[model samples]
Target: MKSCYLTRPGLLCALGADTDTVAEALFAGQQQGLVLEQGWLAHDHNAAVRVGRVAATLPILPPAWQARASRNNRLLLAAVQQIMQEVERCKQRYPAHRIGVVLGTSTSGVDHAEWALEAHAAQGQLPEGFQFEQIDLGDPARFLADWLELTGPAYCISTACTSGSKALVSARNLVQSGMCDAVITGGVDTLCRLTLNGFTALESTTSELTNPLSLNRAGINIGEGAAVFILSAEPGAVQLLGAGESSDAYHISAPEPEGLGASAAMQAALRDAGLDETSIGYLNLHATATIKNDAMESKAVDRVFPHGVPVSGTKGMTGHALGAAGALEAAFCYLSLTDTQGRLPPHCWDGVADPALPALPLVQVGQQWRPGPRYAMSNSFAFGGNNLSLILGGGA
Candidate 1:
């Protein structure tokens, strides 16, 4: 497959409002971004959990997209705003029908609906200006397509945690197959009571700061954010070299215990990039901090990179962004390539290794980054055994 360039990228999360700020905090291992507060979800009126909430004020939606207004849309709009100029240039470079938008999301305005239902429960009527379609998963894509006046293929992907990464794969397919000339591809997800409470019900919500690969690891902290990347055939500083996908369907919530599916995805990614695992300088793990996930992922990492590569799970820095996680981490890798100081994102944990899990090298703060155009990979494993791995060859 021909290399697809990831040109301009925008990001917003608990770490920072934009890519540069987030990258600085991420590689420096700063904890100033991940803050905790009470009442994370509507269902949890009592139990307070730590969450990665965006602290910056959001922009008002355009009157044209007011009908689809929601926090999710706001986050996506924020990401796009950072690169709007480049986006407009691309629109002019290609016909409207030749440009595409493909995004991944988990909670699509579900929070707004939650508020509407509350209003109805008390007032016996829906909110005055409430629109029920805000909960639609495709709303983000539709709004972006409509706003851009793009006539090419536009759609949303909601494949659990792998949604964002798979969207990248889909975008590459569109460009490679001559279906489109340029693509605005990435993902957005907003925090909501449904996701928070749902994970809590499954005993996956941890009360303490998430401890990825720690012996005392509890679970994950739910979060929300957006990451947008302009992908095209034009050469750029970073390239989306390969993506590997697998659906092992081992369990609904739990991954395959033996790490067969997870390892396969990593191996496939390396294969797609035509590189050996040893060539990878840094690895962004899909370590959710859950007992099962860390254990399964550790085994997979051990199998693939036996020589030991610097690895880190960014959930401790930004929390788990769920559907937006894959692309968000990829943006981190993109920054890794652009950073001239050569600093790798450090592993933020308690330094207590899980005795039962396979031991792998974890990147520490102040560690020297890989020199030159290095290779990196980000893992995103979702429910129903949906696992996706993306490989980038640039700065690591």
Candidate 2:
């Protein structure tokens, strides 16, 4: 079997536009979220919840390109462009046809759809302003391919929150299957009235920043961001290691009580990695801070990693990027392994622990691990029991 490795990864989140800003924020333990003050929604008008919104406005593209893309696709474009900036360096080594693209997104172009509807209602015609090209799930991938001028395989995975992780898995499969030699895999999502009001209708939006594993933790706060990674078949590459996906069919919006599907996904990822539970040094948990979701995740983590491994959730800092959450969190895990010399980022806002939850050792402060190669895992569980886990290890 061929092993896929990450060559260069780019990130743009609320922490900042690049990896340096994100690293600085993580190391300094500074929180970047703020309450949404003004937006196009009723619930978001005076929403009290703090969101980790990107501080910089998205860069404007060519007018032609801008007219045919949605806000979320714009974010994805930014992240992909950052990665392409490094492609010239790799071009000397890999063939262009060997490269592929696999992206993860849930509500792709829903924002555009909403705008189209409003424009049609107001003007009594399909809005002359709205672009029809951007209202598709595959638009982001297609735009990225055109931007990079690559003619390889292109795909979009939309497994809700697990979409990003699944995209990574797809990239690995493409390389291993000899379908492509290199790939770009990641995720992007942007805040919109549709998602905000939808989650609000579900009563899943909280009035404050979430507290994962906290006794008083409330619901989740919706956030937006994008992350991309370059994967290649080169030796000494940061290997994908392993990945697993499972579905519980337990409920539409809630995980099963015992975390059956979550556990299966983690176990399968470890098995695919040819590793044991004890070998995982750190865990990037999918702690959205919601009651049922957090509780279910806690149970799953306790079942797999009970040896007091350092565990934290970046959602507290990044908010839940929904469709992009898996990719963003996986990028954090990959960065945590490569940048910090094996140290894991701490859980930034853990004020009180939940007594009813499992008693696993949660690393509340940033701590460094032994300097060397080590293994870490990232978990992403979405609505409808869609679960995905990725195992990443340091490059040789």
Candidate 3:
């Protein structure tokens, strides 16, 4: 099968939109997560939790784009615009027909649905001029394709939190199958009361900032962001390397204990990359800070990388962006690979250590590391034990 390579990638997250800004913040050990302001959490008394929220509101898009008011759509549009601008710079290499767009989002436009319903309750009718397409699950992908004039296949992946990572897999397949010469794959998720209150109802909303793998760790704080990457068949680019996915079917909202399925996903990714576990120099763990999730992840990592490999979770900086988490973190990995010095920001393990969590070498300080790693892996496990892992590395 033909290989897929990542050419250009970008991110818009809580830390900052541009790559330099976000990278600087990460390397500086500057924390972006903060306690929710009282104004934003007017009614929720449990707003003390620190959230990784973008300091700036999404900018206004063209008038044509504004017709779609869904928060998810807005973020998707922003990411797509940024990605297209990059593509335009290298337009000769990736033409229109050769390009594709594949995105992931769990809540698509549900925020708009909630707003429509609320407006109807007060005005006795659905909000005027509200287009149903704006709230459709495929709207983000379709709108992006149209906006970029991309004629290749367009798709949307919605497998809960694994959505973004799954989209990358889909984009890789499309290129390997010769369906498109180049593809843009990533995820976008925006803040909404539905997710906030829903997690709160499940008692998964952490009271304090999340402490992944910490014995005192609480739950997870929901966050919003978007990330996108350009993939092609050309050489010299950061290769996708390989991807693995599995489903345990244990529960709708919990991972299987012992991480049976999560372990399989990691092992499969390594097998696809044709490398042993020891070859993986660093890992971006799916440390959401939730008890079950963190425990299961720790077990999986221990099973795979027992040599004290460097591992860290950026969720401490970006919170949990759900569907967008995988893609955003993947962007971080890509940056780590291509930056002047191959280095990644340390995972903020601020609180006391947790004895129950497995012992893995966690990168806890921001510093430059020389000699780029040959391989790196990213893990994304979602509800129902839907697990996905991707192994990426410097060009062969």
On lDDT, the leading prediction is 1
How far off is model 3, as Cα RMSD?
A: 2.3
TM-score of each: 0.97, 0.94, 0.93
lDDT of 2 by residue, 1-396 (tens): 997787557888877788777766765555655455455456446545456687767767787676656887778877766766667656556677777888998777788888789788898887766777676777777778777777788878888888888889999999899998788888887777777787778877776777778898887778888889888778654678999889999999888988889999999999999999888888889988888888888899888876767788878787888878888888777777776444567886657878899976676555866554678899999888999999998742
Give the better candidate number (1 or 2) by lDDT.
1
Candidate 3 is scored at a TM of 0.93
Residues 78-176, candidate 3, lDDT per residue (tens digit)? 666666676775456677777888998877887788788879989999987677887777778887788777777887888889999999999988988
Q: Across residues 95-128, which tens digit of lDDT does each residue of candidate 1 receive?
A: 9999999999988899999989989999999987
Better of 1 and 2 by TM-score: 1
Tell me which of candidates 2 and 3 scores higher on TM-score.
2
lDDT of 3: 0.79
Instruction: Show the colliding residue pairs in model 1.
Output: 337-395
Model 2 global lDDT (CA atoms, 0 to 1): 0.79
Q: Report residue 271 deviation for candidate 1 (angstroms).
A: 0.9
